[model samples]
Target: MKYHFFQSKYWVIVWSIALFFFACRDPKQNAKENVKEGELKEPQEENAHTTVIKTIPGGVDTPAGMVWIPGAMFDQGAVAQDQMAMGHEKPSFQVAVDGFFMDETEVTNAKFEKFVKETGYLTVAEREIDWEEMKKQLPEGTPKPHDSILQPGSLTFKKSKSSVPNLYDFSQWWQWTIGASWKHPAGPNSSIKGKENHPVVHIAYEDALAYCEWAGRRLPTEAEWELAARGNRKDKIFFWGDDQDLLGNQANTWEGEFPVMNTQQDGFERRAPVKSYPPNDFGLYDMAGNVWEWTGDWYNTNYYNEVSSKKQLLKNPKGAAKPFNERDRYAKEKVMKGGSFLCSESYCASYRVSARMATSLDSSLEHLGFRTVASVDMVKAEKN
Candidate 1:
């Protein structure tokens, strides 16, 4: 049920593009209440110093490219007054996660290449489209597209030369480029020649799972991802602190105009090399930007409300059992964390620690990537 209805079928392409637009909505529409520009509300003074992150140390034989994240209890959603916070990030709830070893950075192109070469694997973007399978997510009586248009490809970001009328239309910038896979990120013309150290983009959930299986790891749960992203900073807006001013200096996000112009103020226009920016206090890199990382959770808009209703601290709670986005019921979505280079203050400022987005499980986008985690015992087994 990969929902990559491409450009050939005009209506399907629009629907797919609409999903991207919905996920990356304008910041003005995301605010619960309007506040004066340049003004940010900080958390209550009393609660600011209460929570302390207790990180365990990785032993001498710790797993390669991983860091120990000591588990602790903390609120798992947006802070008190995150103006850019979206509805899906609401109803902050207390949750606990056990210490686990997580990747220091998103899986790199070199590593993914190693996996593909050894297994002769094909990413979702490399696999040919299945008309019958795709039809399941499409409306009834829709005719099968021409075989020529059904070629394998992934969604690629094509920046517009000038600003468009509105940001609501995702089709203005996102194009379904044929031959767009991890090997050829921009399309047939592009290659990962010099970007081996950069994170592997155009990775679908299943593709991530395949790599995790090979590496004896698993995608981090949404709760764990949030906790890790928060790092040693508790109840903060950005992973670094409550200050939005640090965003341009601390993370790889769009500075000037979003699609049309990236001031590259952060010194990166696209996906920066892994660890291009400083790591979080817990020694995790690219937790708030660079690219959106996949989490092992089915995205439900109301999942937070459901958890908040419990009113008790949840211990390592898994996410909603099923995907339930009212916007597009037919397309199944999983939780994606951290914003990409495309995120901006004018657009979706998803680099905040609590920012959450729903991305289709089958999506292999230029801005989508993933990292893996291993339990303490899993790490110990590696020594055997």
Candidate 2:
């Protein structure tokens, strides 16, 4: 009974906004930490080395559109290691990831447009979602939603006149507007004409995968994502560190009140262009805020326990088998690392490095976007 309401009510809210402050998703395919099928492409020959010893230094060839993330050993979780940290991120353990190339900035509209123009690839947001596809996540014998409700649209954040709206009911902030895609960010009339440099939004996991495939890249694993994010500064509160006001412009996060009002204290009501904020130590941009980055791990609250149990220096640690969101068992969700533009310190301070959010693979949003990474082996193969 509770699960049904979670889907019926929350689904309507999150599905329209990709997420309402990082909420529900499909449990099976949308496992919070792990990505569903078709997210990874097969590695071809010339992919000889997947992990390189830290002792070995530079000498490898560099790739276009990406920067090399030097291999390192570090603790990959909440730096403060305090009560405020989410349980799913507790018991920080030592994780070693080999050097790999990562995008200097999030995939931008102009870049994704080039991919679409060359491949004529249409994103999931550009197509209607069939009820049959949705029923698979619901209980048996569930009735389909209205056709209009299934139109090609992504979730978007909407503020209400009531400054103090119902926080419990996110419907006040989330709306399933039609024609909300990478091209039409806010709605049918919105355009990315001048915002081409901004990070592309309204991208599903698979949609990101499609862009990666065409570009000969892949999404970063949880370990890779964290390693790259920390920029070798392990166990720090954020990529920048413990100080919230570090640099006086720590990434791009909400300033004033959340949900009801965003004073744009950071000079951004929504997403600022990629690299708008200062880069991390490794010269990586937007590692903390800007938009929640998709990671290649299944959502598991106990995933840390699984890693801690390993007890040994883990290598390329993958996420658990499937996601189990105790709050909404029916929602399949994937891990969304690095919070979004909507994240406010007062409400959802998911911008912290260890912070984790979840949403369904089928969902899209105005604030959710992803970056890409190349496996050591794949890069080797490409060079060969």
Candidate 3:
């Protein structure tokens, strides 16, 4: 699990699953994952014994810092015109989702800091690598790395000095930076002191879950997240209700040459504050650009195909029960929607609203973050 970007076509299957599956799996199950010593803190559930359904006095109300996303039927995957559609997006099917509350934007650093202060939490990126626990996630005979190099760290992107032709090897730009926690975004030298409004990065699944539990929220399901990202404008190539200039600062994405030079036309070399651009039709911010938001779905290369084969209008799909990599059976990954700031048309054209990426559940990177949903039903399930 590290930084990776899959190509637009069949190549998406192998790399996207392994790269984007970073910690977006079920919160409860992910919490059980092994972390390096002193890396994990037992998450708290104050109302674990209470499973009663709680609705607003008026029946359905919105949660603070969230928008009410009216449910509807929409084409959930690659449409005919989407050239950037990945192989997994095929057999696009109709999906029906119930109305739910979703965050207006990615969880800002200020919001996450409040959760950390309240819960006394430590993200997985802040701890050492628990090789014993990690072995279960990899091939049985995979050799472990040196202990000295296994210290707490997270993936950070490094732009190249000059343009290069080959876009296949993603590791050329992605580096595992020591001390790259949520607080220290780029590395130990960087800080979030004045960046409270920026969306928090380096968030692993557990970190996101802990924040949601503290706020009585949950990560949106794959369908729900896609529905909201569309902003009720189905069939559009991008999330802005129409295809705009992705090469410009239409949203926070690579402008010049990807992984090489960036003009910073949008005025940001790193993360931009939440709501830096106009909100979508649903009044949602950063639905397409900014950071990649973690979805609750466990990714399978053929999950959508399986659903399409069922030949039924799916309802509120939560994704596969577990991650399965077709190319590497031992690898696990989770679905992450909404390509990040690093997404580029020249490389990973994942900025398309339907585009998806997957990676391991333990990976955390500078461009990965998440928002939360406030579905009373989902909260009830979490409590139980």
Candidate 4:
């Protein structure tokens, strides 16, 4: 198993299944692993309370389709009432983020198309796989898979015709489809012909960074994203409020049995068009669900432990220098905020504002997308 791991059918099945979970992990399962053997204590609320103080827009002309998020101080993690909170989201601590302009919605296909047309850029999903680089994320001395499995592709979610008993096996629903890039989200047969306004899917971390660089903007830090996604609310599990009843009306998420059925009560089974749902208090659309947005921070399960221990307001804190996912230590994961349409109460339930998930840095999937943010100074410089 150690010498020729990729050659054996048993090992290949294991490897593929491992990759599937790494690509779109079960947030609920990961939550259980984050805690110790004993009962988990929620983050102390000593610094969880804060008022939404308004700040002047500073006379900086706002960018088109971007809203100004006023600098404010607030708790950065799960609150006392979030029973669905994960262990990684523990240790709520006070954090302050400066004013910045953020996209009103996730980056749409039309905008991404413009970037691709102008730059002739190829997304990571479209690029050929490099086993040399990919193996770095696997255990040492792990043999590479056959050449056929190394084709350019991305993970695509397939709805199960019937209820599946093994929710832990992510491979039951996620498929590694060749030619499943942003342009062909569902697979080679699928096309983004009329879904231009929908958030672009299958965007890798580097692809997002490339788009941000071209637009003179950057991905939001986890703190900045949390602040913006919070929409200036105070101690609310959801952006709309603490009410769970409002989830269906406020955002797009799985309505029926997850992976088996979606009632589309929100009028979308998968990713919806930008602004398809009501905006948050800060005028940001789909911040809680629709598609999980990437943050600039690397995933670190214990990062909040460090932040909460500081006992002081952390200003624009970047994430850990490297990723550390307890379940997949070999993979380089990044923090993905907000949830996706696939999220359901029975499963991920990550639609809550504090809900966070992790995916490999090079991983891309249909339910994943990102938005960009620009500092006031960056916007000013772009105009000047």
Q: Over the stretch 1-384, how does candidate 1's per-residue lDDT look in tens digits?
A: 011111222233334544312232111111122223321112122232334335554563458899888788889998987877777788898876788889999999999999998999888788867666666445567666667667788888988999876776667788877788999998999999999999999997778988988899999988999988898887889888988988887899888975898889899889999988899998999998888999987777678887777666666766776666766554456788988888887777888898888776567788899999998777767766
RMSD of 3: 8.6
lDDT of each: 0.76, 0.71, 0.71, 0.77
What C-alpha lDDT does candidate 3 achieve relative to the native structure?
A: 0.71
Task: Flag regions of model 4 displaced more than 4 Å.
Answer: 1-14, 17-57, 135-144
Return the TM-score for each candidate structure. 0.85, 0.84, 0.82, 0.85
**Pairs of residues at least 3 apart in sequence or in different chains that clash in candidate 3:** 19-359, 20-358, 20-359, 21-334, 21-358, 21-359, 21-360, 22-359, 23-361, 36-130
Better of 1 and 3 by TM-score: 1
lDDT of 1: 0.76
Model 4 C-alpha lDDT per residue in residues 272-333, reported as the tens digit of each score: 89998899988999998888899987777668886678586666667676666555454456
Off by over 4 Å in 1: 1-60
All predictions: root-mean-square deviation over Cα? Answer: 9.0, 6.0, 8.6, 7.4
Task: Identify the superior model by lDDT, candidate 2 or candidate 4.
Answer: 4
Tell me the tens digit of each residue's lDDT in model 3 across 1-384: 122432211111112334322222222244653323321122222222322222233444465677878777777997788776778777787777777788898999999898888878889788766666655444457556556555677878888887766776675687777788899999989999999999999887777877877887878888888888887578887876455564354578777788888778887776889988778888998887789988877767768777777666666667775566675565456689887788777777776788887766666789999999977565445556
**Where does candidate 3 stray beyond 4 Å?**
1-59, 134-146, 246-249, 376-384
